[model samples]
Target: MLDQTRRGMAAFGLALMSGLAPVSAMAEDRPVIAAAADLKFALTEIAAAFAAETGTKVDLAFGSTGNFATQIREGAPYQMYMAADESYVAWLAAAGLTRDEGTLYAQGRIVMMVPHGSRLAADGSLETLRAALAAGNISHFAIANPEHAPYGRRAMEALRHQGIWEALGPFLVLGENVSQAAQFATSGDAEGGIIAYSLALSEQVSRLGSYQLIPADWHAPLNQRMVLLKSAGPVAEAFYVYIGTPAAREIMKKYGFGLPGE
Candidate 1:
């Protein structure tokens, strides 16, 4: 009986030690992620899920990819970068900021959104917008700054493709990033904004306004990519693998994003 008691006590002690172990001693760990602003909602949820499953935490910093790229070049301590466009990731790879081959994580679609109480029709096509502009109903339109945001560049491309760049040029209100552009639309600072469908599907925006998807063909595809930095730890690699799993892909789809392989 005494031997049995001793064995039980030893087992309990081992279990306690395991439970009390520091997170740094774990086989895989969490990584600091620098992500594009448009991915705020989706990536947060995904990060939480990844943490629950793998005991990995994702410390995320959300901003424009261009700015993040500049920071990374300046030696920001991020282990991974998720950009809203492939070009940004490619540029980082060229600059030796990350691994040469980055994974294409998701694709984004653009939309036009209006404020909660606005009576504006949900017509997002160029012709519809032209008519609204002619009527002087859309006083301010928000877009991300094209200098640093791929979505903004796409918005500009769409306007130019429709031959309305000069006509709509006067009403353009620029946000620092796509998420800010959505905020501009939601806060009524701008009557409408061209933003990512991902942001449009977010709970805050969905409750604050409605969106009409811009035609996919109007601009180049927004293929977002994620690259693991050379400085990435095992946790970062594990998280990267987690994102490509079926579970994460489902989460992305729920948030109005499409996976690359899909």
Candidate 2:
């Protein structure tokens, strides 16, 4: 559906370009922003910084990128969206749901993680996992639901690259989103799981398990993209800008996200 709501979007961008605050912040005190679950920790820190620096609150909802895209298509009231996979944003832009195709804010990586007491090792090469599986020592392996989660899709690709996807099905534990997948990966419920490197790097997750970075060539790059929806306002627009700032980029790097330029 053509987004008739996008008619005045140019004005918002122009105002931003002119170094002026958008004309209105809208009646909503907080703009709802949808983000991919891989950003759970990093984006939270950035949002906290955003509020402290600008004194404006932005509500964030994190989940699978594909699920959010479906909601956005059905007119969900998200003012901005940050997707784990850029293709989702591109699809929305083509449907006229976005102010534009948006920004490639970050690139994500995956890691295989095992809880503290697991028999499996967090091996990037996945040789340990292959050996453990062959020895019948594997119980459950976790990942996000590939049907709707970008991290899960990448995990599938990586597993396939190693010639294990078909055999691992019976032991697979799928989470609805990558963050939950991370939770499952480290919660002692499974042997180990492939999950977002950003989540694996966080203090909360690192304390629970050990992780090793999967080779980037194993799957497609997680080219994250962010976009403003038709209903975006002053605060939402400002928050969008804040994401690309040096301060925000620094915070993202702290959590292992690859910045756009460096």
Candidate 3:
């Protein structure tokens, strides 16, 4: 009877083991976050860190704040929205799309980038660019589309402030968003372009090009903001809070973002 009971217990243990799902097999349902193009790298690093520490996952979709605002307004399924500017977050909040007024995450900066080995100086000043254009050496330049991208609008402001908006108009190659603008400049598709400083600091861009910081006074401040959408689940809410942690702030700082309230 003792041997029989032992066998039965062993069989039951095996059955239990067979029925249990492996932790690796069970995928965590990562919450979807719509983040600004400027955060393509910074937020990605932050999200990966959040997952490593908390064992929770997050899905990030990077794009223009204006495009994202429209999608959220039209009922896109994202649980969180991080904009390049606070105004978009406020717009969503006013539309009753967010849990509350969103929190400022960081301030972004712009830089002018040229592909590696370009004849034009990589100096942050626009003098080389103007000379190149006037000399007909540079045929194209890129910027995000000002209509729906905050960075693009800022680029426009910078160009206008420098009194070169109209002169450079014919050579402008507008990108869908800032990341693409960076790509264009890095790939030499456009001679060079103004893009987010965060991107300029990224490994990929760093490897392919050099950038000079566009003076903050050249354009409006890029006060980035993030909000938990009304449709956000627990995972999204938790990640939203995690974004405020020191770990996240450090990652942003590493990528050239100015910490909020700093």
For all predictions, the C-alpha RMSD in Å is: 15.5, 9.7, 16.7
Pairs that collide in candidate 2 are none
- Residue-level lDDT of model 2, residues 1-262, one tens digit each, is 1111111111111000113243333545799899999898888888888877766778989999999999999999999999999999999999999999899999999999998999999999999999998999987888888889999999999999999887787788887888877777787867989999998888878888899999999999999999999999888888899898888899899989998878
Q: How do all the candidates rank in terms of TM-score, highest first?
A: 2, 3, 1
Where does candidate 2 stray beyond 4 Å?
A: 1-27
Candidate 2 structure lDDT: 0.86
lDDT of 3 at 250: 87
Q: Looking at model 2, which ten-residue stretch has the lowest summed lDDT? A: 7-16
- Winner on lDDT (1 vs 2): 2
lDDT of 1 at 68: 91
Q: Report the error of model 2 at residue 11, Å.
A: 45
Computed on alpha carbons, the lDDT of every model, listed in order, comes to 0.77, 0.86, 0.80
Pairs of colliding residues, candidate 1: none
lDDT of 1 by residue, 1-262 (tens): 0011111111101000112212342654456899998888888888778767765576888889899988988899899999998888888898887876699989999888877666465556867677777788776777788888989889888888888777777777777788877777667655677888988887767777788888889999999999999898877777778888777888899888977767
TM-score-superior candidate, 1 or 3 = 3
| Positional deviation of residue 10's Cα in model 1 after best superposition, in angstroms | 59
lDDT of 3 by residue, 137-215 (tens): 8767778888899999998898888887888887777777788777777775557889999988988777777889988
- Local error of candidate 3 at residue 153 (angstroms): 0.8
Top candidate on TM-score is 2
